[model samples]
Target chain A: METKELQEIASLLRFEAVRMVYEGGDGHPGPALSSADIVTALYFDILKIDPANPDWADRDRFILSKGHACPIWYAALNERGYFQPKVEHFHLRQLHSEFQGHPSMKNTRGIDMTTGSLGNGIAIGAGMAIAAKATGKDYYTYVICGDGELQEGLCWEGANMAAGRGLDNLIVFIDKNGYQSYKTVDYTVGRNNPAERFMAFGWDVQEIDGHNFDEIKAAVAAAKQNKGKPSCIVCNCVKGKGVSYMENNNNWHKGVPTKEQFALAARELRGISL
Target chain B: MRAFSGSREAFAAALLDMAEYDERVMVISADSLKAMRAVPFGEQYPNRYVECGIAEQCAVDVAAGMASCGLIPFVGTYCGFLTMRACEQLRTFIGYTHLNAKFVGFNAGLLGGEREGVTHQFYEDIGIVATMPGIQIFTPADPAQCYHAIRMAAEVEGPVYVRAGSGREVSVYGNDAPFATSGITVWKRYGTDALLLSNGFVLDRVLAAAELLSQREIHVTVADINILYGDDASEILREMAAANLVVTVEDHNINGGLGSYISKLACENRPVRVHRIALTSYGESGPANELADAYGFSPEAIAQAVAAARTQQ
Candidate 1:
């Protein structure tokens, strides 16, 4: 698909994510909006997935490691026709809801791994990638880790494993959205250069603007072409990328937008006066 | 029967046996390959064997990820580390998802004492894993039974935790021993005066005590309660009910190991005096048998407990 077509779909997914958070009454809309474009770009372009046949043996595996940002993921999966009722009517985090607070591979189709806890995705994705290699299957594993989630020791543990095992089939994208739950990454981890850290671990590094569809496309292409070592594409994104009121605002990390704020967010995403 | 070196060797041999036909079978470790005695598996199928450095959580998550891809991965590590350190990973990813993964916790009971004191001596492993649903635990009698338990873990579908030793376990069952997938297996049945239940490597002591008690005319039906967790063990519960007195012998802690299970069963279902003979505290650096003896896990301790229980009744 063209960049224009992808951007349109991404905007629609962003609106769906914001709406789900507003309706669910509790969710992290900031991180969801921060990761919206990357999520859209992967599902629509980068991933070798079959929404119709989710359990296809050779399909590329994607793990949403920063699982608090699941509204965006639910939006992508729902829009891609993985399951029923669509993103708008979904009962997120409800009793027996497919759209759980964190993504579950068991409850939701198209969810490759269950993640909510910050640091599990990279190791799990590495496992999947190694499994594919062991079985002589041609499939890649892509994992998206939150910038703050990198504080978890398992992320480094997994990064070291991927690099050590020569897991070229694995590609990790760090959603370096500046801000975490309470503050920005700079305020906590000091500069928080995810690309340099992954490179030090011997990974092929590509630092890019996360919201740019073209940059995401190019990094993913470079990552796919790189051999021997695993790749890490640091996606420098805004905490609340598309929403004017939410962008770079740490309060929106888990804050559910009020009626007026939701209207403003809706208008911003839809590019119209709500 | 050919006397195997240790339960750790049986642990490796079983994986070798499974790999003959099942290509999906592989060993994933957190840099404890030698400790697990899985060097042979790694040597045989180097491609399948994965060493995730020293990260226990990564090893388990790798297993969960591999299990999701239809590969049966047996993650091996220290008993205390695997069950405690990567506990959330086990409970959340493997247990909650009900992934087809196997875990062999080496240096169980006091077997790890000689290596490095209390840090390695893990008696709370069974209790920790038992709290999580969808996981079946097996504290096999000895090396032979550990083989059958590890083999059975591969046969079954869901998650299985096989408690093994640091090459210190004595062989209990014969070469042709038939291990039931789940439930208790009676190793010796002299009488029902006092039903003696045991698990893990300490069953050797229980059987010896059973023989000594039999000589003293205090006959008891000795059973190795190897398969600790299953959906139904009513037949064994009925046996426990028939006996006037029940005693559980183990090398693990009395709080949450075999003793606790038998006590809970007798307390809720059938009221009986469940005498527990197991470790009450951690061990210091010593030989496996000396640690076992200090912990009152010797054959004499079992006999003494039985004699005391018999006199009380």
Candidate 2:
């Protein structure tokens, strides 16, 4: 797919993800919006997956280490025809729905690991990459983590292990949106460079504009071709991309849009369509 | 059952055998392979083994992740660390996620490094794991049973918690000894005057108790209640109705172990007088046999509890 097509799909995914959250009345829309483009590129262009054969042994595995952004993942999966997009099931925690507050492996299709507790996804992705290498399976493992979740000790544990083991098949993307659940990245953890940090951990690091399809594709390609070391793509993203009212706003971290706000956000996201 | 061996060795060999047959079999350890007797499997399949180095939480989450990618992950760790230390991750990642991960809790019950004191002894592990929904809890009676249980765990889907006892040379079952996940085994039956239900390390002692009771014309029925998760209500109730008394035994605390489950079963179903023989409190540093005696988990202790219960009536 062309760069323009990927961006358009990302916009569509962003619009759908926001709409799902708005309609579902609860979710982490900010992270979902922040990660929309990368998720779009991976699901549409990078990953070697058959939506029909979700359990395909040779298919590339994707783990949403920041699982709270599952609204976006579910939207992408729905768009990819993994299942019929049931917008109603979004944010259905403990309600026996496929779309839970966190990404659950049992409830959803295309969800490789059920992750809500942060810092767990990277370790799991490393395990997957190791398994692939051990079993001689030609498949890559991609893990998308929150910038704030980088504070977790386990991520570094996995990062160290992955680099030490030389799991070149594993690729980690840090959504470097400068905001956390409570405050901005600077206010919360004080100036920390994800790229340099990952580089120090022996990962081949690349800093990219998360929303830019070309940059994401190039970085992903580089990661896939790279050998002997795990790759880290530090993506600079807006907390709430496309929605002016919510963009870069900390309040929208997990707050559901009101009916009026939802309408306005939807109209703005869809442009002339609404 | 033809795979007659010691429990720890049998579990290790069975895991290796499973890994040899299935490339997806992966074992993660918290630097306790020698203690867990998983060194053989680790040596045989180096790529399949992960040494997580004393991090139980990492071991659990990593296993959950490995299991997510179609790998049959057996997390080998001391029962105390696996249960008490990294329990939340186990509940969330393994139990809640329903991953195909088996937690091989080595040195379960008072069978752990008993000389290391209360911290290493995992007397409450079975009770804790059994409470988690969707996790199949297994406690193999002997080495032969452990082999079958480990093999069967691989075939069974979803998360499994196998409480592996330490290398204590208890009486091994015959070569023909059969095992199943949900079924309780009747190890010995002597006219059903009373039913002595037990699991794991307490099985031999319960058998001994039943044998001793038989000489006193008590005619006790000894049951190896290996499956400790569910109530085993129907089986217990039937035995309670048939027998004059119901006595439960375990190398665990009286609060939530096999005895508690059997007591609940007896109370709800048959309404019989139930006698529980188990550890009443945390243990101290000593030999396993001495600790068992101090904590009232010895064969004589179980027998005396049953005799006392019988005499009360």
Candidate 3:
């Protein structure tokens, strides 16, 4: 896929994610929008996934470690034909719907692990990578985490274990949107570059603009070429992107846009329709 | 019989046996190999063992991760820390996800480290874990039973919690004992004047009380309940309904342990009177025997509670 086509798909995903949040009356749209391009590039262009065979042993595994931003993930999965998208039942807790508040392996299709509590999905992804190596299967496991989620002690434990074991099949991406639930990353961890820190921890670090499809695809391709050590891609993204009213706003982390604002955001994403 | 041994030793031995047969068997410890007695397995299969170092929460979460990758991870930690300290991780990562992780909680039910006070004592671990959905809870009485239970838990799919007693050795089941996930075992048979139901290290005390009561013409029957969570209450209620009295003893808190479950089962099934003998509250620092006596968890206390209940009738 070309860079322009990927960018168009990402814009559509962002619009759908925001529309789902508005319709469902609850969601974390900021991180979802921030992660829209990366998820879109992976699902559409990069990942070797077959929607018909969700449990294909050699298929690439993607885990949303910061799982609250599941609207964009659901949008990608639905676009990739994993399941039908239900806009009305997106964020309802515990309902017998296609999507859950957090991804559940038991309830949702195409979800590898159920993740909501911070700092657990990466560990599970590491396990998947280790399992693939142990079982002699050729596959890669990709885990995406929030910049704020790095504050958890378990994430470092998992990172150290993955690096120490030389899990080349594993790749970690951090959505460095620079904000957490309560405050900004500067207020939380105080200006530590995630790529440099991961590189210090013995990872092959790649810093890229999260909204740029060409950069994301290139980094992902580079990560696959490198072997013998895990790769960490630090994606620099705005908290909320594309929509002018919600861009870089922390309040949209889990906020639902009003009906009027939702129409305006949809129009901005559509952009005069060719 | 292969001599008397503790549950921790049996668990370690069984884990080694599984590792010898299956390369996918992995054991992760929270720097408690000496405490959980997995040194033998670690010595033999160093590659399959992970020493996660003093963090029970991280230990359990790592085990869950390992399990997700198709390795059967046996997490070894003390009962107090594994259940209480890392409860959220256990509930979300393992229990809710129904992962294939076996959580072996050593020193359960105040059996070991009695002098370590309330910090080390875990009186409600079994009850607390039993409440979680899709968890199989097992409290073995002796070494042989622990061996069978551990092997079964590892081979079986889904999450399991094996609450093991301390180093106090006892001989109850022989090598021929059957160990199933949800089955209960009967220890001694009497004419059924009264029935004594027990689990964990207190099973020996219940047997001693039964022997004493039998000599005194009480004719008590003893049942060693290994599977406490979601036990077949119908069979127990039928047996209790026929008996003149039912007494339950355990080295655990009175609220959520075997005694509480028996009391609730008896009241709901039949209108039979039941007597409970267990620790009423938190324990103090003291020797094992002294704490057992102070907390009313000894054989003498079981006999007294039964005798007092009989007198009141």
Best by lDDT: 1
TM-scores of the candidates in the order shown:
0.97, 0.92, 0.92
What is candidate 3's lDDT per residue for B265-298, written digit by digit as tens? 7778787777877777788778777778677866
Backbone clashes in model 1, listed as residue pairs: none
Which is the better candidate, 1 or 2, if ranked by DockQ? 1
Question: Candidate 3: where is the Cα deviation over 4 Å?
Answer: A84-94, A189-193, A196-204, A222-229, A272-274, B1-5, B180-182, B284-287
The segments of candidate 2 whose C-alpha lies over 4 angstroms from its true place after superposition are A84-96, B1-5, B180-182, B211-217, B230-237
Worst 10 residues of 1 chain B by lDDT: B1-10
lDDT of each structure? 0.88, 0.81, 0.80
Q: Which CAPRI level is candidate 1?
A: high
lDDT tens per residue, model 1, B139-249: 776777777788889999999998887778777788668675547888788988899998877777888888999888888998888777567778779789789999998
Q: Give the Cα-based TM-score of candidate 1 against the true structure.
A: 0.97
What is the docking quality class of candidate 2?
Answer: medium
Candidate 2 lDDT, B44-134, residue by residue in tens: 7888888776667777877887887778988877887898887888898888988888888877777555788877877888778877898
Pairs that collide in candidate 2 are none
Candidate DockQ scores, in order: 0.87, 0.57, 0.50
TM-score of chain A of 1: 0.97
- What is the alpha-carbon RMSD of candidate 3 to the true structure? 2.8
Find the candidate with the highest DockQ and give its number: 1
* Model 3's TM-score against the true structure: 0.92
User: What are the runs in model 1 whose C-alpha is more than 4 Å off?
Assistant: A85-87, A272-274, B1-4, B311-313
